[model samples]
Target: MARFFTLEQAQQLVPEVRRMLNEAVEARAELEESQQEIAECMRKAHQMGGVDLDTGRLVLLRKRVDELGKKLKEILDQFEELGIQVKDLNIGLVDFPTKYRGEEVLICYQLNETGVGYWHGLDEGFRGRKRIDRDFLDHHEGDLVH
Candidate 1:
């Protein structure tokens, strides 16, 4: 079941989520770097007729790529377990599920934002985000009593 969070509840988790998201982003970047390096190596090998390829370095790069991929997956899994939606890893965008006026919506947060102050409908996404206001506060629902 999807876990719904009130604005306050989502705000409370920002710090921890930010840390994990940053870690995940770094891991993803490293993974991409490794993959690019491997591709370059393969390209070189193909062009040189595989005559001077360093198999050992290629193996090590592949291993590092695997490790970094696993690390990124673990971080993403943590977000899943917590019911947080990772929208954009490169920019550290996420959404906390909630219901506004009896309809499902998202409490959106981006890296370095002051707090959870924006929200949008499921289909609206980031582009349609609206700033939290009194109407939103009076209508949103979550699992928490407050």
Candidate 2:
């Protein structure tokens, strides 16, 4: 039998998942900044014949870049650990696919909110997101691994 979740329960789970995704976004931003810095350093090094008094600085920059890369990986792993797969971010919502009730459900989470109160069928659009009800939730509860 499939177990269903109440709106309150689903709402409760959204906060932690959202937090994990936000952390991943922050990590990605940091990684991009680190990459830009590394590229700039390399550009400068090339301009200086690949060996200059700033060689030591270049080495440090490379190390920082590597660190940022590792951090990004770690963040991504953490996000996955939390069962979040961010597929898109537009306006203020982050869209992703998640399992619910033995089926793949498209969930859209508001970045500024705590709960994922909106979702839709696999082939449905935004308007397809029906209000979560007891019967629907019950049909899919057994599918919730988390």
Candidate 3:
């Protein structure tokens, strides 16, 4: 089942979620860099007839890529377990599902933001974010069954 979050509840998790998001973003970048380096090395080796290449460095890069992939996966799994949706890894954008006026909406957060102050409909996405105003505050709700 999809877990819903109130603005306050989502705000409370920002600190920890920000840390994890940063870690995951960094790991993803490192993973991409390592993969690119390995590809370049392979390309050079192919062009040079597979001679005079730094195989040791290539092996190390491969290992680093594997480690980074595992780390990224763990971070993503944590997000899933928390019921947070990762929108953009590069900018560390995420969404917390919530109900506004009894309709599903998203509480949006991005890296460097101080708190969760904006929201949008499921189809609106980040581009359509609107500041959480008095109307939204009064109507938005989290899980009610519990």
Candidate 4:
């Protein structure tokens, strides 16, 4: 069975989650910029008769690009482990599978500071989040396994 969290609870956790996602996205952007620089260097190298000042610089650029790629991969892996999905590179959102009662649910972070209290159904809007029921709250309080 899946466990459901109240919208308020979910909201509380959003700020922290959003911060993490933002870092990941920034790292990815850096990686992309590194890749573009490497590509441009390679193109310049190829144009210079295959042996010139630009060729040596291209080698260094390639190495830097490789390092950025590794860093970006690590960041992405971390984000995945945290149940976050990169939708808009500019905005971070949590995309984790959750459960309410016995039903599967999808919870998203709105970057609010309410802590994991807000939640919506798979097909519901943010306005649809309701206060959790007593039974559900009790189950969570007891830390019961789902």
Candidate 5:
């Protein structure tokens, strides 16, 4: 069975999760920059003539891209190991799967946001985010639990 988080547990993770999201967001941005640099190198090489297999700069760019990829993968693996679903890398959006009213839903968190305040059905993605009840979050009384 997939890991599930209770409302209390999810709320408790807000601060740490926020930190993790920030790191992931930064890493993803760096990875993207490396990829763009590599693409530009490829474009320049192709524009000049047939590709040069022994080009130093191109080789360096490729190496940087590989390093960035590994870094991003490590961050993602950390998230998975924490049972957080990576919904959107661009926004550093993630979902914590949990049960509510006997059904599964996700507690959504995005890098730009503070605290987990939204949720959506198993079928609903970020676009379907619904504001969580402040009452439920604050007290956790009578709120759904896993």
Candidate 6:
């Protein structure tokens, strides 16, 4: 079943969720960098007549890339287990799904924010966020995700 979160519940989860997100984001960057380094190493070897290759260095790079990729995937799985939507790893955007005004909507938060303060309709995304306020809270209903 899909998990739902209330504004208060989502806000309360900021600290832990942010930490997880940061770790995932860092791992993601490292994984990308690792891939680039491996590619560059191979390119350099091929360019140099495919001889005098640094096999040891290339092997280490590949291993590091695999490790970083595994770490990234683990972090992503943690997010899935938590049931929060990871919208953008680059920007650290996440969405908390909950009911407002008898309709499902999303409460949005970005990496640098202290707390979630915005929400938007299901069809409207980040660009459509509106500030969370009394009206929004008053209209909120449904079971909150743990």
lDDT of 5 at 13: 78
lDDT of 2 by residue, 34-140 (tens): 67877787888788887644667767767876876787677666655545555543323444455566676766566776566677776775667766566655654
TM-score per candidate: 0.96, 0.62, 0.96, 0.58, 0.82, 0.92
Worst 10 residues of 6 by lDDT: 137-146
Clashing pairs in 6: none
Instruction: Give Cα distance to truth, residue 2, candidate 1, Å.
Output: 1.0
Candidate 6, residues 5-81: lDDT per residue as tens digits?
87888999899889988998898888888788878878888899888578898898889888988888888888788
What is the full ranking by lDDT, best candidate first?
Answer: 3, 1, 6, 5, 2, 4
Clashing pairs in 5: none
Regions of candidate 4 where Cα sits further than 4 Å from its true position? 1-6, 52-56, 83-90, 110-146
Note the residue pairs that clash in candidate 1. Answer: none
Candidate 6, residue 37: CA error in Å? Answer: 0.6
User: Global lDDT for candidate 3?
Assistant: 0.94
lDDT of each: 0.93, 0.61, 0.94, 0.57, 0.76, 0.86
Clashes in candidate 3: how many? 0
- For residues 1-146, what per-residue lDDT tens digits would candidate 4 score against the true structure? 33343444445546666676667667767777767876776677678855644656667767777776777677667656544443344544454455666665555554433444444576764556655556544433211235
Off by over 4 Å in 5: 50-54, 134-146
TM-score attained by model 4: 0.58
What RMSD value applies to candidate 4? 5.3
Tens digits of per-residue lDDT for model 1 on 1-146? 88899988999999999899889989989998999999999999999999879999999999999899889999999999999999998899999999999988999999879789999999999999999999999999998422
Full-model lDDT, candidate 1:
0.93
Using TM-score as the yardstick, the better of models 3 and 6 is 3
Off by over 4 Å in 3: 144-146
Q: Model 3, 1-146: lDDT tens per residue?
A: 78999899999999999999999999999999999999999999999999958999999999999999999999999999999999999899999999998889999999889999999999998899999999999999996433
